[model samples]
Target: MSRKHLHVVDSSSFELNIPEAELELMEEMISAYEVRRLGSRNHKQKSVSSDTAVIRSFLTFIQKAPWNATTDDFDAWCYQIGREQKVATNSQRKYQSAVQGFYRYIVDNVKFQAAVLDRYNLRIIQLVTEENKIPHVHERQRTNERPAFTHQDFESFIGAIDVQIVEAYKFNSKEFLALQRDKVMFYSMYVMALRNSECCDLNLSSFRSNPNLPEFGDYGFASVWGKGSKGSGPKQRAVAIDHADLPPLLDWYVNDIRPQYLQKPHCDPNEEAFFLTERGSRMKSGSLNYRFKKILGYAGLSEKGFVPHCLRHTFTTHASSAGMSLEYSKIKLGHEYAATTQTYTHCGDEFVNREAVRYAQSIINRLSDDE
Candidate 1:
């Protein structure tokens, strides 16, 4: 059991008596929830810790065990958080997510439900509803959170990584190999706009040459297992890596740089991971994060409230600014809804004005050709 658990009852609240078995179930659910949260989402500590706090707060507010709580109880708890606590909309949604996961465990996990019911004669019910969910306001619009990095900024970041690679090579440092891999990993991410987990999960089989575009070689398409909502599991999508510049970079990395990471004496020749760790195992999202942080630090980027996922935002903004159609960008980014993809776009005024002129000039040129 997590010793970090919080007390769920107060002296002022109605006295509550939970069966030992039921209490144990709650603890177990918390433990399992932590594992599930860490495994699926890239959230490390904040999810498990904050979720536990949210669960404890919900339990304390209700003054009853989870199974005994009703939808009305949950509705009130949400109301209190938003109205009294005045947490930001995003915080409310996080609370929703934590509670939703608990209820899902209670409702879906047959073993958990059976054990609790057999021992305590209690049935767990989902108290959360769509009615309880806070509407998602696009943070890009609202708080100016991590305004998408411009293409120039993204280039600077990649260039900084390049400089580090050169410096490591100059020193003949062992870090040269790892820096080379980071370059490919981050470059692919920027050009293709892959999620951190998606990029981390890449293996040799994830790429294929577009027969029609022989120049791109095996870099024309990338298979991505993208994140879906909780319990939806990962949905597979194909991202088109058709940009002319992207293909050459990917080709260079695959042919030249990737083999270096695989050359250890003990390294398995059959290891198919596109990106390998120092140990020759597949790269993990956390490892990807460390390299991402190093890139950000070298690029002199502010690390506050930013993560590797922001690269996806940068890709979306740059793609839109460059006149990629929303439908094309939506499919490329693996967003199910066009509106969701819009939230990632952060095109600036200059790009908008330049693009307007380009569009006008193209139409004028077309008219001249017609004449």
Candidate 2:
């Protein structure tokens, strides 16, 4: 199968004709890899999704390229496609990563030799540099800043969700179920600090209930399979349940609601996905986003640009403000780097003021003792 002839579809129903075993293997690799890297050092969730997408594209790209295609061929494809779309630098990096991961999988798992894989890796690195130096059609100035959110804005958003629930009561049962689902889903995304993919990929099996703990362990923590979690590295991490406000809704959905709704005979037994569409199928990433937007509007939180990830930002901000250690927060968030975790350290003015006061007190004490 040539890459050019390989069919990529925009709709969900479109299926590729790749061997079932191979396709299954690829999916397993993606899932298993994510699980292993979840709590490991140097594991990044963002890179995982990008890499998977890249590898899928690469499979098609390779099928189309000439049998005699060399490193130059790969380089050309990246430049042409990447420039045509005016992809950002980070996107280019992800494309490179995906190709590299694909070749690595081929070498490590398939009939290909290790030497060939090593050479391909080297070739990819060389090509990435070559392509990066050639400016794309849209070369915008790079900004080194990160996005920040204040504590008050976070509180206001949560307050708005409370208001939404009252309005939701006015709707009938079915409409109210949809409304509550969206509300709880947004809350889960923020409280759990999950990526869009992680949020969408969740299944009933991911939640493990333990009713025996001193506190309400009835709502067990979720096992998250992070991005780039395939192959040899660590991939899975657990998010502990703590907040009193969030757990009841989560438990309700997991134990009572999901089983009632997803128990239809048409529902695939193999698919134990936690979130479902009204038609009783596993939710797609797009649906998750749609639901998120709908709920945000209902909550009057649309003004905050309250996307799915903003919830994650909310988690980090709240955790940091609560005085959780940076190291602990990194582990909880499943971030591989302290630097990536540091992006969430935007404390409230109260926290900043308290720290300032404490520091001043320490300084005064030190000076007085010296005198």
lDDT per residue, candidate 2, 286-349, as tens digits?
A: 9888876665565566666556766666677778877778887788788878776777665657
Top candidate when judged by TM-score against the true structure: 1
Misplaced by over 4 Å in model 2 are 1-88, 91-152, 155-162, 209-213, 229-234, 263-271, 348-350
Clashes of each: 0, 20
Using alpha carbons, what is the TM-score of model 2? 0.60
Cα lDDT over the full model 2 = 0.61
TM-score, cand. 1 vs. native: 0.64
lDDT of 2 at 101: 52
